[model samples]
Target: MNVLIIGGGGFIGSRLATEWLRQHPESKGKITLVDQAFLDIIKNNPGFECIAGDFSDPSLIDPLLEKKPELIFHLAAVVSGEAEKNFDLGMRVNLYGSQHLLEKCRQLAYCPKVVFASSCGIFGGDVNQVLTEETAPKPKSSYGTQKAMVDLLMNDFSRRGFVDARCLRLPTITVRPGKPNAATSSFLSSIIREPLNGKATSYPVAPSSPFWILSPKQVVRNFIHAAKLSAKDIGDDRTINLPGITVSVQEMIDSLEKVTHKGITDHISYEPDAFLQSIVLTWPPNFDTKKADALGFTADKNTTEIITNYIQEEHIQVPEK
Candidate 1:
């Protein structure tokens, strides 16, 4: 099937494009990747068409959909910390842009299966217990609020037969290959990424502070699984929290030590930023992923596996001291 990936230039988006192509090797249709920019790898692929533009612009989105992409993966967003710091930019891109895309999908002659990349950040503000499919979202950040809104739209749009959609509420994906972005949970990746690159990184929260985390690999798998799933499998609810393992900040560091050397632990330091900590502290550390698990979604085995997988996948070079 012809596929369209919004924000296909970003970390998760780019990886999903690659993995999707790998999984569908004998496919006949071109995979269209729409982003503000594109990676050379995707642009060079013969079976892929890379479109660089703003999805918020109806002009841009309309023409892209007219190309008739039957499967769409929506992974574009302003992210948590950036959205909180700049409300207008966040609303325009995260909220308004999402609505515009949905409207375009409604206008399409054929319904497309949309796999939206939502966030567990949607659940925050005194989330002290394990969050489940039934947990109500009490979003504290503008980013979280926007994601929760999109989750609603995904459900309603699917219910209305506008688009066959599945909103996967992804956790903080760790060991991202590139430099950190504005997302507050970025530090979670930074702690492992930088130390491996021989640079020091700081943890913005307490050592005991836990996070529901998936690896980049698992997140991509979830995206594909969501897209390939039948409407009957998802039922009426188009949104579900994807499976992830919860690990503390200290536990992540410990994993780094296990994967690399004990000396790698020295590369990490704690210097809590209250703003970051407040946003993080509000998110539930654990989740009951039984629903997602039963639905065929999966999580990482553990933190050590998370680290080792990153190293192998990224081909990271462990610096010699």
Candidate 2:
């Protein structure tokens, strides 16, 4: 299968590239990684090629579609915080960019399986209720609104036989191995990631505020699962909520402490950013994953496993006392 990852340079996108190659070592197919920038790790792979360009530009996506990728993983977007702050950029990249890609897919020689990386941010505002596949989106932020719009477009395109699409409403992926990005949820990873690197990071939300989280490991597995499932197996509903565990800021810090020591935990201090807190608090921290569970998708066991996985995967060095 010729696979194309739209945001193949980002955290989940790059990891997905490695995972795809690992699972399909014997296959004689090309993996194209497209992002504004790329890491040498993926760019250097013999089976893969990297394209650095804006996905929103028709100039970039048109030729890529001509490559006739059998699988398309659309993971690019302006993250929540930045998206909220810059409506035009979010609309351009997240909404119009998605539409452009899907339109290009419609022109493909074959109907490719398009795996969209949606977000839990789609479910915000008055979210005291437990969110489920049946729940409706009441997006409170520009980022959430854009994702929700794309989800609708993806479902419509699939319904119209344009592309075989599966939209996974992903949770807040934690312990992402990199500096913070524009996502309001970046702090979720920073609190653990920075402290382990023996640096200080702030907690923007209340310690008691909960977040639905999945590990980088699980996210990659779920992406593969989403790609491999047949359309009938995935059913008519192309959008499904991915399963994940919930952890509060305090719980995350506690898990970090378990993995390291108080010295690491001491590096983290709560200094609330009201804007971030408002955006994050609007999202429901819990979900009913029965749909995802039935479909054989899974989540991390806990935040402890998440942190440990990050350490091992990134080869993070722990400072000795």
Candidate 3:
């Protein structure tokens, strides 16, 4: 079975690519990674083909469609903060680009199974109760709005028999390796990974701030599980919130203190940025993932396990202070 991973060079996308190859080694088809950069990273591996270009370009997608992958995992998007800042770019890349891909699948004689990586940000604004699949989405950020819109498109297209589409609404992925970027939630990973490596990190939200988080491994697992789920089982909903651990900022810091021998808690300083705080505060802190659980998707055991697993997976060296 062939697979095409859009935005395959990215953090979660790259990890998903590796997981796919590891799980499907006996398969004959190549795993085509479509991205603008980092093609060199996976280009050499057997059954891996790196195509470097913008998916936003209509001309670029035809060749990809011609290849006729059996499965398409769309994880490409301008993230939360950047999307809110540049609405046009977010619409072009996140909304328009996704619509174009879905349309292409509709045109195909044999539509591929599409796994869309959506965000929990789609369920924005204040809510004391846990969010379930039935909760009506009220997105506060442009990024969230775009994701929700595409989610609807996925459902509509699935109902029309255009494609076997499944949307997994992922939570904020924590303990991510590498340098920080424009994503407002970057600090969630930085606060853990950077300080563990003896580098300073910032927390742009208050200590009491609560949000849902999942490990990189769990995120990849969700992608794989979604791909394997039968269309008959997934049904008309077409979208499901992947399970995650919900914790406050203070709880995260407490986990850091317990995991690392050294006093890494001191390394973190909270100076809330209104823009970042505003976007984050609007997001749901927890989800009622009963549907996801019943469907066989899993979450981390707890925050400590999540942190420890990340440290081990990333091979982050603990500092001697």
Candidate 4:
């Protein structure tokens, strides 16, 4: 399949490129990756063609659609914190940009498979309720609102025979391997990554605040799996709440302590900030992923396995507990 990854320069997108190529070594297909920038590794890698451009721009994205990539992975977005702070940017990229891409695909008339990276942020301010497939989205943040809107659009487009879309509502991806970005949930990775590297990090929420998390490993696997499913197998809705494990900030700290030496979690601290709390706390914590379960999707075994996988995957030699 001729594949296109919209946010391919980001860590998740880059990793997805590698994993996809690894799985289909015998296939003869072109993979194109577009982003604002690229790491030397990605740009230099012979596995895929890297394009530096903004997907939100019709000038840049239009010509890309001309290539008619058979499999489109729409992973680019403005993320939560930045999206909340800058409504215009979020609306432009997260909402309008996506609509432009969908319209372009509709013009092609060759219904391509689109695997979208939606978020649990779409379900907000209902912490007491366990989010299920039937749960309605009442987003409290602009980021969530944008994603929820796109989910609706993707569903409609798929139902109308414009695109074969699969919208996977992703959990907060954790244990990322670099400096934290503008995401409000960036603390989730910082609390684990920084401490393990012998640096200090702090969170802007309460220790008991719960987050729905999935490891990067599982996210890639599930993304690939989503692309492989037939429309009937995926059902009519075209959206699946990808399974994830829920853990509080305290539990995440505890998981790190379990997998590493004592002082590892000691490097983590809580310095509450109302702004981040307002956005993150509004997100619903728990989910019922029975539909995803039936579709053969999977999540990390546990938070401990999540941290362990990150360590091993990064080749970080840590003193075990």
Candidates ranked, most accurate by lDDT first: 4, 2, 1, 3
Tell me the lDDT of model 4 at 45.
77
| Global lDDT scores for all candidate models | 0.89, 0.90, 0.88, 0.91
lDDT of 4 at 55: 95
RMSD of candidate 1 to the truth, in angstroms, is 1.2
TM-score of 3: 0.97
lDDT of 1 at 286: 83
lDDT, candidate 4, 111-220, per-residue tens: 99999999988988769999997899998899999999999999999999999999999999998998999998999999999888888899999898889999999999
Model 1 lDDT per residue over 1-321, tens place: 788899888899989988888889755247888889877887888767788888888888888889888899999988899999999999999999999999999999888899999999989866578888789998889999999999999899999999999999999999888898899899999999999988988998889988999999999988988887899988998889999998999999988888888887686889979999879888897898887898899889999999999999889998765
Residue range 94-145, candidate 3, lDDT tens digits? 9999999998888888979999999999988765768999998899899999
Model 3 pairs whose backbones collide: none
| Clashing residue pairs found in predicted model 1 | none
Q: What lDDT does candidate 3 reach at residue 288?
A: 90
lDDT winner, 1 or 3: 1
lDDT of 2 by residue, 103-125 (tens): 88988767889999999999987
